[model samples]
Target: MFLYFLTLVLMVMGLYCLIAKKNIVKKIIGIVIMEYSINLFLILIGYKKDGIAPILLKNVSVEELTSRGVDPLPQALVLTSIVIGLGTLALMVAICLRIYEKYKTFDMSKINKLKG
Candidate 1:
């Protein structure tokens, strides 16, 4: 229950930063935080109190393996999500650099020439 509450708080804080902050860099940071929080939550879902690595040996029986091993699906999903997050973060940073080069300021309001 405590873990769930902490995860929820992390998620909310990340979302608040993403939605309320105007700086492009801060938004990128918020996005990264959100991604990490979600990854943490996913990992928590597959956690077992006494989990062991999921490996299948020739001598291992099906029932024994099922009862002792950790779930691999969430680990795979977290890897994919982390890769996607890195790609997005890179793109966001590149765009922010371009914006800075053009506008000479990190302030979002000052860069709002598109507002009409």
Candidate 2:
């Protein structure tokens, strides 16, 4: 669908940001964008038109549940991925801050030149 194509485009944009940017913060933002795009893709994979939540109600038959329920696995995976992404983002920002403290610049080329 168009959504999948959009997701791919978003990922490519993120990749471009990661590869083409010079600032450490911008690179970090690119990584976050890529992560978010992947999460969006996963969510799209599990989506169903006119689907209900996977939760079972007393009145719902097994057949009906199977026919209409959206998948829960991808949602769970996305939740876990979000937590992991947050941790990684924090770590990256901390490293960037330390690099700035040492080099006085967020520019990668400058940082490389200043490296002892």
Candidate 3:
């Protein structure tokens, strides 16, 4: 519902920042936003209305667990994605720091001096 549109808007905002921002750090942040938005979208896609945790209890029927419980796969996938995102963010920051060391600036335009 509203959440889908919100996630889509967030994705677009992230894309805009990534493409239009001139600061390297801002671009990195945009990448993170985009990643998060995608993760949120995935979680929403796997959502079940009136869903409960996918836990098995002795009193609960297998059919109830199957029909009423939320899918655990997406949650697991999101966890993995978060870890991967962290690694990616760290790599991006490390690269940014190296670039800053070279140009003494975080501005992408200013770093163009290295083109020569």
Best by TM-score: 2
Which residue runs does candidate 2 get wrong by more than 4 Å? 113-116
In candidate 1, position 100 carries an lDDT of 96
Candidate 2 lDDT tens digits, 1-116: 99999999999999999999999999999999999999999999999999998988999888989999999999999999999999999999999999999999999978765445
**True lDDT of residue 107, candidate 1:** 78
Reference-based lDDT, each prediction: 0.87, 0.95, 0.94
Ranking by TM-score: 2, 3, 1
The TM-score measured for candidate 3 stands at 0.91
Better of 2 and 3 by TM-score: 2
After superposition, the stretches of candidate 1 with alpha carbons farther than 4 Å from their true spots are: 58-61
- Kindly give the stretch of ten consecutive residues in candidate 1 with the minimal lDDT sum: 107-116
Candidate 1 displacement at residue 43 in angstroms: 0.7
Number of the top lDDT candidate: 2
Q: TM-score of model 1 relative to the true fold? A: 0.89
List CA RMSD, all candidates: 1.7, 1.9, 1.6
**lDDT digits (tens) for residues 33-97 of candidate 3:** 99999999989978999998999989889999999999899899999999999999999999999
- Give TM per candidate: 0.89, 0.93, 0.91
